[model samples]
Target: MKIAYFDNNATTRIDDLVLEAMLPYLKEQYGNASSVQHKLGRQGSHAVEHARIQVAELIHANPKEITFTSGSTEAINTVLRGISKSYRTIGNRILTCGTEHKAVLTTCEQLTKEGMAIDLLKVNGLGEIDLQALEDAIGPETVLVCLMAANNETGVIHPLQEIAEICQRKGVLFFCDATQWIGKLPLNVEETPIDILCLSAHKMHGPKGIGALYIRRKSKPIQIPALISGGKQEHGLRGGTYPVHQIVGLGEAAHQAQQKFEIATLRDYFEAELLKAVEESSIPTKGANRLPNTSNVLIKHVKTAELMTKLPQVAFSSGSACVSGDRDPSHVLKAMGYSAEDAYCSMRFSFSKYTDREEVDSAIQQLKEAVAAIRAHSPIWEMYKDGLI
Candidate 1:
């Protein structure tokens, strides 16, 4: 059976063009990017720089300000922990949202162990943080405020520009984990005052194990100590021999994402038809500011775990991949005031450039059938049908 995959938020299928771009690096041009004397080594170094330029251009950042790491998790840890090490003396407070990925939340938790204050700002039902509360949270003691440009689960787009203004006014550094938003939307750091931003290539049709960090080098350059310590790659900040092929793939993915911005229409159409077909279906952030390619739908009287087993033709995610194994209902849905049952029934369906209209149509039919079967099998749904809910 052909699978209509809608799990781009967890990770994406690397584009063929990106894979082609990395072939030369993997075979003939294989050389340590750190080596300087040999011709192949110099070529590898030059290729790494070119990839840096490509990734930087995608986010409207300078090439010098971009640094490569394994992925967003490492990049996030590098900034959050590095800041705590360097600027902890200045201020020991870190602020972030409750809906952030485990990378930001867990790192902040680690910081709290070291006597740093970690504050989690609550989000409304629409999964939006209160701007006034954000301002109030930023005080003299706040060293950095970490927030994602887009939520991974709910697909809600946070107001990074306004948040940046607040942090700027309060002299607190703002670090954004833009993993879910980078390839799907336009993120112009030049226009926004985001001090630091993190993104992964795998989220954007790039290879896994490769990502970039955008550090502002303007009037007030946000500096931090190195997190990894070994070789002097990534300007001695990230220490390791660069994976030439993976970096090349990341650059190509960024280039492709910059060219492809029309998939949002397909995603919207998918949600419209799915909701029309399944009366019980509702999108979590339907009217809120959300990513164009994401839809977190809650189908009442159905558990996603049951639906997944039924819809073998559709590939999608119930929630964040990192926490899916924990078998817990989505923290994002729970934060939005969903009951435990509602949260368990909610599922995330993210689209990509490869998701065509026909696939979406087929997937909608499959979903309607699967949800109906699951609800029919559900005793609670039967109870509700008899007015006992």
Candidate 2:
């Protein structure tokens, strides 16, 4: 059977152009970026710098402001640890939303155990942070506010500008985890008042194990405590041997994304088709203002896991890959006021530029059939036939 991949949000296939760009580094150009005397080292350093520039250009930030790391998770951890350690003299409180990724939430939980006070901002029914609640949450003791540009599970874009303004007014450093939104949407650091932002290359058709963190020049660049303290690398924020090939791959991916991001229309077409099918079946699309490439749908009588198992040809997910094993309902859907049953029945379908119209149509057909089959097995459907649904 042919397979259809609609799980782009979990990870994307690396672009061919990006792989071509990284070939030399992985083969002939292999050298430690920290070496000063060797020609190989110089070449490696140059590649790393070039990748930094490409990433910085995408966000309209200076090349000097970018710091390479293993991935977004590490970048976030670096920022959180750095800020908490360096600025504990001023404040020990960090503000964030309840719907953040495990990276941010788990890091905050660890810091709380280390004696830092954490304030989790609540989101409204639409999976957005309550601005009034944010304003009320800020205080002199608040040192940082971390929020994601778009939610990983729900695909709902947060009001980063407004959140940034709030953080700016309160004199708290703001950090944005743009791992989900970076390549799919346009970003301008000058326009968005974010002080720091984290992005992963793999999310946008680049190699995994390489990402960058943007540090605003205007903000008092905090002396971040190093997470991996050994060699003096990444301006001492992170210390490890740099992966030049992966960095180059990330740069090439960013460049290609900048050039071909118009392919987002492919995702738009997928959404349109999926929504039409959902409407025909009387299924409700969850929430509003989701990303162009993502659709979270609730099939009333069908369980998400059962539906996916029944449709083996379709590649999709019930939620984020990180939390897939947990039997609990999605925290994001729960925060949006969805009951346990609705949350459990919802599944996410995320597309990419590489996805074509035919694949989308196939996915829709498979989904429709899957839902029908599952509902046929459901006792609720039988009850409905008996005038009890």
Q: Please name the candidate that would achieve the greatest lDDT relative to the true structure.
A: 1
Q: What tens-digit string does per-residue lDDT give for candidate 2 at 301-377? A: 67788888888889989888888788988777887788997888878878887888888889888887777777667
CA deviation > 4 Å runs, candidate 1: 218-221
Kindly list the per-residue Cα lDDT of model 1 for residues 110-214, writing each as its tens digit.
Answer: 888999999899988999999999999888888999999999998899988899999889888889999999988888988998999999999999999999998
> What is the model-wide C-alpha lDDT for candidate 1?
0.89
Candidate 2's error at 87, in angstroms?
A: 1.9
- CA shift of 323, model 1, Å: 1.1
> In model 1, what lDDT does residue 29 have?
96
Reference-based TM-score, model 2: 0.94
What TM-score, computed on C-alpha atoms, does each candidate reach?
0.97, 0.94
